[model samples]
Target: MMRASLPLRRGMPTSVLGSVSANLARPSSVLAAPSASKFTSLQSNKAPSNLSKRFYSSKTPNEIASEAQADFDPHAITAMDKQSPPEPGADFNVVIVGAGNINFGSDEGPWNHSFRLEHKLGPRLKVVGLIDPSADRAEKVLDVKRKSFVLSAYKDTIVYPTFADYVRNRDPAKPPHAFWVGSPPAFRGREESGRDLEKALVEAFPNAGIFIEKPVSTGPVDEAFAIAERLKSAGNIVSVGYMLRYLKVVQKMKQILEENNLKVMATNARYIMAYEHTAKLDWWDKSQTCGPIVEQATHFCDLSRYFGGEVDLDSVLAHSLEHFEPAGHLRRVPVPEETIAPEQRIPRITCATWKYTSGAVGSLTHAVALHGYNYSTELDIIADGHSLRLVDPYNAPVLYFRRPGDDHEEVVRYQSDDPFFSEVSNLIDNIELGPGSAPILSSYEDAVKTYALTWQIRNRSEEQVRKLGKGPANF
Candidate 1:
């Protein structure tokens, strides 16, 4: 089994503020002064009372709004207009940014997992450039032919050896047509690195379609909105890496919901990976990498909303725990003796509840305390007359329909192929098709929604911890 640990690499200073570091000074006036009247009713009625008892017993509405505006601007929305659909088979050059494990050949990485998909895409979609802070790593992963363009170091593209100059000097006729950002979450005490890479991409390649990894924002929500806004203003295609959206099982689940004319009542998702699989990296700690909510549960939140078919998030309550006493004969991994102080450690367990605008409810539970390589995601959708269930990350998702007269279950399987290809292909098509067409499977807007929900859960959970005068284990 692959262990999840932060690798210690000696090179860049940890504190260097990259181009995309959180810049809280430039506030969005719109988010700062949202229409309070429009949200008064919802705020008063749906706000979690437990949160008030624990964290905000004496806070005023204005104070809460101010704090929220600092993290996220409810009013910010992408302004990119959908363009006219392109002819089928139109070719485009793509520049892949961030040679992290997800995008490139890391030890047992997903990038290599998607190789068959890349082969399927063929010559039309060429990998024009590869970007990563580590030149050697990038070179090893992106070993292009002699005639192919392979820029090793990130700074090499400009005057300081940056991507800017490379793009400028490249044939304007073939400027990178698209951009794929497969970097990890800006956790691992490398928040600035993630931000810098994003800023560089935005400034250097404004015209390319941009795809970012999941949990789009690792720190302040406002920073994420700002980045999204910049991309929107630049007329860039920003698609987040919520791979489940493209999964055959999930697609079939969507079809099931539409076919039954059902409305979601409640949803639940659980993710369990071995602690060893996660604790390998330094950034795996909660304060840096984000709790399971932002790091992993974000996927569940997004998929729930996707299946629920709603946009407005009403409220959230969350709790977490970092240590567990082994029970029975269960063995426990010994905590590292050289581990950082307790506060910086990631939680082993997390639970959160979401009340959506559509009157449906959602809950998520995830833990790294499990003993084996186990990953299970189940969504329970309850409607007026029946309930539907979806299970598994891959195809052959089992579906159970419970109706008044009869109870039956059916398994829907997708043809044997790479789910990533399906999603990437759809993204390319969406980029070419422009906006207003059958909306892209997942959009930047969806990314923002998932990110916001994850942020609220983590923030709210932290508030609970602070109010209780205890650490993460209390939850």
Candidate 2:
């Protein structure tokens, strides 16, 4: 049946990246600009007296990558360019759950999630169908000329309004092997919740593997945990889109730590995003995008857990500056009047402190109000006699390491490595290799712990804001 596909609205890109590097010892430059300390001192009651009216000069991701390329090995770059051909009659057929621009290509061209997946998997993977309510979105993705690289790669792909609709109408001889949930973070009450969509898909495809986006749930820990439990009970292949875990540099960092048996003592990380560049207002609202911590900052939070071990919920401390300045002075991105409650909006700047189960003290400072496009996503670790840092894991990701007695730090660059390729390829391996063989980087259950920490930070920050009773006047 030739049914009309539903049209869905699209949002701006909020890219997430994690840092990793390897070296016994080498010379180093400062990983990134010295961590901005002023964000932590900003108070809700008082406007930032030193706020810079000008946006910081953006260090374009391409520019950063160019610099990093100068340091990388040509052989590594050449190896990453090679794509392995798929064997005949592979059964890893998949379907996408969203048809927005990010699912196909962004404003800049075919560099979005789906494009990366298609290009990386090549013949090894096949996108047999898509599930979205937006007919416009469906129409857009199918327009081969616009996204020729992505659309042309697929031999044939069907479209449906819902997962159930796709499941019901699918050809029994060629059922979908897995689902890639590309929709935004959704909740129970609101229909756009990705979590709700996943539920329906799981109910329809009992043994299907699912690849989900981050901030798995917009609700509390209980809801997130429930989703994790359901997936576990079904014996489903579940992988959360935490791509940093698959970065070669990150893997090397893990190997270095384990090989040397270095104990992590302390960790510091931050995800300072460009708020002014966020054209959409919903992204700033906690009720919509789940705030930066859950929405975007979770990458670094997960990295903290990846290196520092499990977090101690009892020891978490957090704070935020929801309304950075007087409402009159703020540059507001217009949103539907009264669509989101004032109390539900999250702060532009937030900071949280916690203790890992391993006794390592750690902190994460997330700010979305930066003036530049150069995102600051970094993690620093202090272990036994060494200090290691992963800088700007998103754009031009670099790694730096130094020991107690070293005068120079060792550095490794990954300006050319595509972590997403590594992530998608691993997901494919997991589906084909079954249990114990494939290394599923960030499983749904493990990602839930990261989601829990984000909620804990938000809850803690809210409690502090309540005690201060110094709400911003803009609202």
Candidate 3:
């Protein structure tokens, strides 16, 4: 078994970061600026107070790639780029709309690294502004030489409160090039900044591209569809936060499925994290975060769909365990104060079986009360009189087999320099080259499917409990 460990540390090697900075410092020479670009020249206006020459000029390509590969076994970069070399100095300006942990900084923050990688990749990309409600959090982006402003308490900063506040306030000839929405998922009886961000993007910069975080919402499916329709009508290119879709390992798995001509029989996925990591927040409760199925397990569900093909649930069954006393000394409460009985908390364990329209059967299981923030994601596929298993996400290799007579395991490792960097680089290339140039791995359609699957599991579980006349119901 591959030893699982967190990828981030305070004093871990800064070589990659330093290399990225060096690349940014090098002048842009790769791609020519778009003649019809919407973004105004920063030189024309007094650059945002936070903007600095250092931020723009960071690292060199060789240095960035070298640092990215230092952590892993040495592999030739050419092995992964046989098709096409990455486009350099592509001009793509971005306006990030949320300052969440995933996008800005976190223990294993892909977004944080992605931003730096974008700088190294070329001048085609720039983060111009950050729009978030919390002033403190917004200040983080402002410190990076990007404009930061508190968004109004309205859905879609562009339409509800009027786009003139932010857009018209600026030069109309040059609008934001793109909007990146990294807000948390909207919960039941709670605030939803994503909807607001989407509205703003559609109204203020209908022609700009957009990137929204996952688990789009906790509400009905129709709402998400409506938002998608609006984006489509506005001629915007919207990408969802299904980052795994761009991972090299995931791509290999897809290739394996196609090469084998296999049919999926059953799939099992589990994600376990430390209770201390999740239990402290109000949104940790299943109802608030749209249940474990939607909030946490949706990624695995999306993976299952990717491997197993189109998933249409025939039925779903679920159960929950609440906090209770062993000797009747303490009565379990639905919502605890200060501390919660282990049992009374949200269901630590969840299991569900989904029957796809293609006649494939699949299962999903997950838990969040492990010893530490240790995450294990696996997919077991039984088909063609054989079995294929993918255990542990970060390091586990794919295991495959042929039949009762032929049994073997072959490791499937990323043959690339850095999968995460490759993901961001591809995103930039797609935007620069336009449609058909690069693959669009993650789409709003896939996100919708994942969201609906999660909703089905959560809603079905609550309905089953209601039918059984059980207490401690979920909202």
Candidate 4:
């Protein structure tokens, strides 16, 4: 139970900004006076807050230089109009930005996951354009067509080194109708808060439906909210990639809870990813991936918020553990030599707990020390007279249920259901049915709260380590 002094906004739903303290700036909080650089000077030896502020400011030097270089006759139709409903079996054009792990598989080369969009969406969603900072990766992605891809459709796909290049060279008459932003969470800004991808997309294709991947950002909350507001104002059909919410077992769990009218009292979630299977060294570093809580275990964190509602930042507390030594458990998995050079380290395990303004408690445990490919992820929700459990949502989804006095537990399993593909289908449906008609399970604004909660966990864990002076050691 919360202390009497803890502030609570009466009758307000607790899931959205429920954990936000009255003293903290709200999501709508913007800088009183904008400047060229929204960020304060980067502090030395400080783990940056997840909710960093990025104010709307005048153009920076780099932006100005880039604009000067790209002087051209602006298209008469600067922005694409609200798309008319697609005729029967018509193909919708989509521009894919970023060529990282989420866009492609985490295998040896860039093409491993390159054709995922085509494999999943196929001819219905044609790839009209591609953008990435890496020229080679972008070229490879456009050139490769993996199994089950229609050969003829990809012939017209165009590649660009940056969003600016795409805008400059793209046939203004054929702007993309939608976007798939699969860039890393930290790829948003150059120095401060910036949504270069979203800005470019809106400039090229207004009212275009956009699907951005999870952990909306690696920066501060101020910038995340600002980016969200920009997308919302564009009237774009936006959806964040929280695909776990679409799992069949998860849906069934919600149905059972709602139909039974069970009031949730607590939520417990765990995500132990296959540490040995992670091929990318940057994924193991905190500066790059923001640790497991924000990077890998975020799906479970999002689920906790989904089941328990929004979190209260004031009620949050966290503990983390990291160990790297010869013959230690850290030796079991591959660690980059540079990361263990006594100046940098990443947490191997993190456990965080927080309360919802709705008076419910929630806890999440995430670890990156497991072996093999079977990700040990699960969520348990305890409500009035009953409890629910969902296991391994990423691969195979399973739900277990038990009533307070029931003799046996009920089990339901979903076979071969891909939530990623389902999410894409939902995005296409939203485009087809038009905005405000088809439902979007997770929007940018909705997912930012989940991102904020994860950041709270990270910030608290770092503070605890600092206070202890020897909690989690650097390499």
Candidate 5:
């Protein structure tokens, strides 16, 4: 829960302003030769030798920069549409709202945002502000990521204890070009938590791009839509982080469907998380995390909607394997004593089916049953005589498909694809290059539907439990 923010006022207390360190007036040097043979002031203590350890990176940022490009005309279409370029040294500036796994990648984190930005953009990405209510927690996460990432970009970054603090004391001259919101779903839609900050960001930095991670909100559909309306009015460039939508393999899937003029008939999605890891965490508590479907499986749910189009909310139906379900080959996940009994916990697995407004149908199966630090996520689309399957989207995503009258399944592999980078890059490009860049696929308004679907799946699944008179003990 968020504490009440200080009302907007004139005089700034030195304590709230202590976090601002970057001298916006004194622009740094292209983040000082970010990924070169020579070291820069912003370079990390590490010498950049552990490339093998990273699971998704195919090449170091320097190797990809390819400094050998020929000079282009300033009159080119890309340069023409580009927004007023930043100062000589600053390429992009953003304020990140959270300091959790998404901001700092874990071995088992859903995605990498800050770590990748520092690694790829180096000193060129100026993080002007870092906000979290728990300043100590935010500092800890920053410390860990700083040690691991290639650049120490946030060494002098501003730290705000709350959104209100950032609002009150932020330098009016150096307003960020974009806002990177990685806060939890619970803080996303509620006015006191999400919308208030969102509205403030809009008023404070009109037309600034916002990159929001999913599920965009944990509230009802109407609540999210209300926030979306405000954003639309401000003309803020909004991109919700459904990163899978940017995958080259997913793009190929879309390309083939368009090439063959195919309409999806049915879709299948499965997201089975490694149970040994997640069960011991707060995720096992249904009330806190809003169940696994909304918190975790929502990626697949959004993907299902991506290909299947608008969902018929009335047609959503779901079932689940209860925590108290009988055990045989499957051992029940141990329940935390604090949560009190297995019956009150979220289900071990959930299966749901729903229809698209386009008449196509979709199904999803999510289980918290795999072992160790492993997870399984895959989605398949079936059109008339064509089939499209995407596997292991997080790393080395592969697409397998068969068009009309094909013998065996053909494959398109994008082992080096970084949808995480693509998603964030697109947000920056959309702001800079406008229509010259590919537009964001998942806008704030569109993401509200995905949030609503996850809630619908969770609600209907729990309703099934209630029908059997197997309600939680608290009831």
Candidate 6:
């Protein structure tokens, strides 16, 4: 059965590399901007600001993707690209949950959600509040966003200790329009999942849309399913953070499949990331990040599903390069020997394969043994007479393909297509203009399927981890 998105609104911006970079050493204690003093949330009795004056003409996934691809250019840097982004004249207000690297960005590049929103919607977006465990970090993230995008002036954004706190103190008259949940995996659908948080948000903000990050859960698909059901009934606009689905390269690939009316033969994806000290320590803990497949490489896994359709979860089989295997080869995280038990460490490499419901097969290979802050990633979609490849989506994204009757391969390189900005922008557009006006590429439930598949991959690969008769001499 074909699954049509639940009238969730979505759209994206195109072209130009971003100069912003998030290098927060300790977000909880992120230093105040050089010219600024300490920051504080303002107490406001005023009602939510008026929605920005903006309208959009977008509908259906394929249609939106086609339009974005048509307007996108690999090398056109406009004057707007060089100047500081204009204020977010948002048509709606949203509360951001979690203020981690994914939200604030890190040394690698700008995954900053706030920056993306303002850059795209100009004076149309306004962050009314932030929800995180650390009030300090949440406030700082808002401060940083305020300084960088909204004229270096503090707005009336509030910081709550948790989502529940925000709910308790929310002014019924000044309700937000949406929420962006960017918390880590452990807090998702696992140890202490956001099951309750999701429920609360839906009930409290029935009219607001929701944008959740990937790997909707660390383990177990049930929690995500339940959240999906709640969101469905509430009729809240929903989007998952599988931004890669919005890439022009990916859009072009889908176009090929449709134009030729071809079925996917097989899809193969890989994400080998550098696991230096640059990453948070939680990333190395499988219990926290749920291994590389669940936490990071999920992008490729989701893409695999996007092109190949539903999966045969029972068909999964996997293998991995354990930490004990070449002791010298796998550069270990700097920590005391006793701090990281064997079970806690992530795999050096993981390779898994499974079948799709459509009779097509797919495979994935993930690694976390790089020395620096870079990732080597790629995805290959094979059809009867066509082959599509997307390379290095993290930085400069490019597409390479060979179509029927073509003797040579053609390449499409995007100078800079920030999928992060596109993701947030589309959700806002959907929220402003109402559902069906745009397409939310990754629905919460749809992202759950991707989450479940990654867990299957991680579990299958770990079956052999305990069969070690003798291990490497010790790191």
lDDT to native, each model: 0.49, 0.58, 0.46, 0.57, 0.61, 0.60
lDDT per residue, candidate 3, 102-169, as tens digits? 44555433335334434434334455554444445456434543333212111122211112234545
RMSD of 4: 13.8
Model 4 misplaced stretches (Cα beyond 4 Å): 1-88, 104-124, 146-149, 189-195, 324-329, 337-343, 471-475
lDDT of 2: 0.58
* Candidate 1 vs 4: which has more lDDT: 4
Model 4 C-alpha lDDT versus the unseen true structure: 0.57
Q: What is the C-alpha RMSD of each candidate to the true structure, in Å?
A: 11.2, 12.9, 14.9, 13.8, 14.7, 12.0
Model 2, span 122-201: residue lDDT tens: 65566777766655557566776335644444657777666556767887776767777665544221122433555666
Candidate 2, poorest ten consecutive residues by summed lDDT: 20-29
TM-score of 4: 0.76
Q: For each candidate, what TM-score against the reference?
A: 0.71, 0.77, 0.70, 0.76, 0.77, 0.78
- Error at 189, model 3, angstroms: 15
Which tens-of-lDDT digit does each residue in 420-448 have in candidate 1?
A: 44446556655666642323455554565
* Residue 175 lDDT, candidate 4, scale 0-100: 61
Ranked candidates (lDDT, high to low):
5, 6, 2, 4, 1, 3
Q: Name the candidate, 2 or 4, with the larger TM-score value.
A: 2
**Candidate 5 runs further than 4 Å off:** 1-91, 119-122, 141-152, 193-195, 327-338, 341-343, 473-475
In candidate 4, what are the lDDT values of residues 71-108, reduced to their tens digit? 21111111112223324466777777655444544332
Cα displacement (angstroms), candidate 4, residue 125, comes to: 3.4
lDDT of 6 by residue, 120-175 (tens): 65665666766665655666666666666474223877776666678788767667
lDDT of 6: 0.60
Off by over 4 Å in 1: 1-91, 106-117, 144-162, 165-173, 187-206, 309-314, 324-331, 334-338, 394-396, 433-439, 472-475
TM-score of candidate 1 on Cα atoms, chains taken together: 0.71
Q: Show the lowest summed lDDT stretch of 10 residues, model 6.
A: 1-10
Candidate 3 achieves a global lDDT of 0.46
